[model samples]
Target: MIKIFRITAKNKILILGSNGQLGSHLSNDLAKLGEVTSLDRNGFNFENPESLDLIIKRLSPKFIINAAAFTNVDGAEDFEKIAYQVNALTVKKLAILAHENNAVLIHFSTDYVFDGLKEEPYLENDIARPISVYGNSKLEGENYINEICSKYLILRTSGVISKNEDNFISKIINLSNDRDELNIVSDQQSSLNFSGFISQAVLEILTELESNIDKEKRWGIYHLSGQEPGTWYEFAKFTQEISKKINPDSNFSKIDINPIPSTQFIQKAKRPKYSFLSSVKLKEDFGIELPNWKKSIIEVMENNE
Candidate 1:
């Protein structure tokens, strides 16, 4: 069993983007460490950036966990205003608030920050050259946290999945409902990280720090992602493989996943062909190594079934 950590005094932890895939899981897991005050789209909507000042001041949380952002890759091409508002402008406010309150700001970024041109997995020090609007906006948010806040942790991950949200796993399941065959992009390569894993890693980091605000080399951006790199085509086929193993009567066997190049599917935004991140630094600092993407697929399929 995973050894859960709980602080003695119950530090107040404010979670932004509580309605998101990662935010939903963080809400429950962070509760084990402290009092989690979750604010989703309905309450702490990033679309309304000006309102965050009052809320952060009122709460004065010891830790601010930002699990929210504008994640629509294609839509960001058309609606850049709201994308920058939510991903960049709002993040700036949260960083400032965390700085003023002397609280630790834990912000989530994307692997999309890198152009995916590198031959190897992305390192924390890699020069970020985003290929799309969404990626650029997310990188801007990371910059805000780095520039304004001293006590901060910026975690950059990719291909995040959750049993709760409409993620890649859920999409495959939903598409399998009616379609007998699916054409998934195979040219793109990246890591698939589960929300549960991401949440646990964050909790462990907090536990290690014990909400310490003192300056340390560990307080910086880290690439936290899956154990291995794979394409969407592989991820879908693996999901089918797991579904059949767990439940022989499942409909996953009936669906055929065909691998295709990115050109086959036209989209408004450009995605990096290789945007996966390296978890070496995360392991070096925190001694946390996430399981393979296949294991996460099995657990996700088990829950969905």
Candidate 2:
């Protein structure tokens, strides 16, 4: 036995991109259960390759979870090189460093790795054929982690709605305060994963990893995300409807929601027509079940209040 509980006390964990929405929540959640050191743009810049290797060798954390990514979908189209540098190259470096230190690397990826043409939910083994630069870069990053890191866990999710300082949720909440109606895309379908929910999943992984520290073969990629799938428009309506309950006087519920196809919604980067991911594998292996979209919505709404 690896003395799982003991490792929790002795192990050092580092979280990259601690400033973003998902990162912020994950940092807070992980800190409660173990020793956690978080780095954001202020401390670590993915663009600067020099800092990455230095930090990894210096910290030698037992667990390294990278929440950092060039998330600007449209911006990625214009800054393809930067996207590759930050998304793919940095992850590769991190994986290499983690392997060298005998640490376990846990990375977050996106459902955008798929082309969205698939009629059903995407499985972990599905062939990744990205239609956009961001998606391709994310897929590349996943590959790097898989190839370089001896022990690793790559979680793929989509429609990540978090309460961090910056995210789609905060943006929607802000805009809802200003406008009565919001236009959201209904054609694209994907599951929504809240930051809080993801934090719980990470905790579970750490708990399991501590117990099986010696079981290196147990390490592999998994799908950690929400269960119920919905379109951007459907999610918006659910969000707005929930907001009205919190702010009864607010007219978010009254907002006119129009379901528009992906073609109608013009964007600099192309999104998968349907990138919904299935949580079957995660549930089977980890005994973890994803929360429903409505349940996640209520949780975020309540947290905001």
Candidate 3:
């Protein structure tokens, strides 16, 4: 059943996965809202769910933003058990804990939850059919949250990148420095979102939620991914283009990025050929429109320099 939540006593905001790129940004930005507590996943054990119950009860947060996730797409295929435990089961525990504590559980999800079968961008309520274990695990987590918690949000995003973390853009720059060319997967289509963008969006959502806590329409899954849709090849090429424009004298400007089919780039996991997410719901509901991939790439490239 859907239960509307209102923050009464404990107004602390707890941020999980404090070490990640998005988590780090969120930790810093959300502090302005209220008393913030940032917890790293390593500090607690997900294998034993009961251990977290004590910790969360002590924290007594009004808002629990869970960013900790097992995001290794390829590694999930090998460590399937651990992946499910960390991504799904642990998230289920979080939902239950938040429901008990009367806290709004804001969780981060992924575009991988949808298989790349549809040509159009995936929406919030679209039927999800994941192509990989990582996707399945994340979907399971979302399902648990939906079933267990009423005052919660599931923000589905794509490849979240930033200069502060070792993301795709940073990796592309590093590879270009070492190798003469980069062969990126062109057949796959998705968006590369900036961590800063996501953090800011979350901040806005938190502000709105705090102001009006009983709005049932505000709680649910929302797409907070990049506005622009492009293939990996396009992302890489844009990275090179921006890096070169930013630092023309650097080697980053000289390296070439080549496009190849997903088959050419062999991997244990199968990625969605198209998982570009549409943020119309987020904008329509929360009045937040995420920026384009090009702008985010430019910011990351400039920071790299």
Any runs in candidate 3 off by more than 4 Å, and if so which? Answer: 1-10
lDDT of model 1 at position 174:
80
Each candidate's lDDT (Cα)? 0.86, 0.81, 0.86
Per-residue lDDT of candidate 3, residues 60-121 (tens digit)? 88899898888889999999999899899999989999999899999999999988899899
Off by over 4 Å in 2: 1-8, 176-180
Which 10-residue span in candidate 2 carries the lowest summed lDDT? 1-10
Q: For candidate 2, write residues 224-273 as lDDT tens digits.
A: 77777888888888887887778767656565777777787789999887
Candidate 2's displacement at residue 129, Å, is 0.2
The residue-level lDDT of candidate 1 at 162 comes to 77
Provide the lDDT at 45 for model 3. Answer: 58
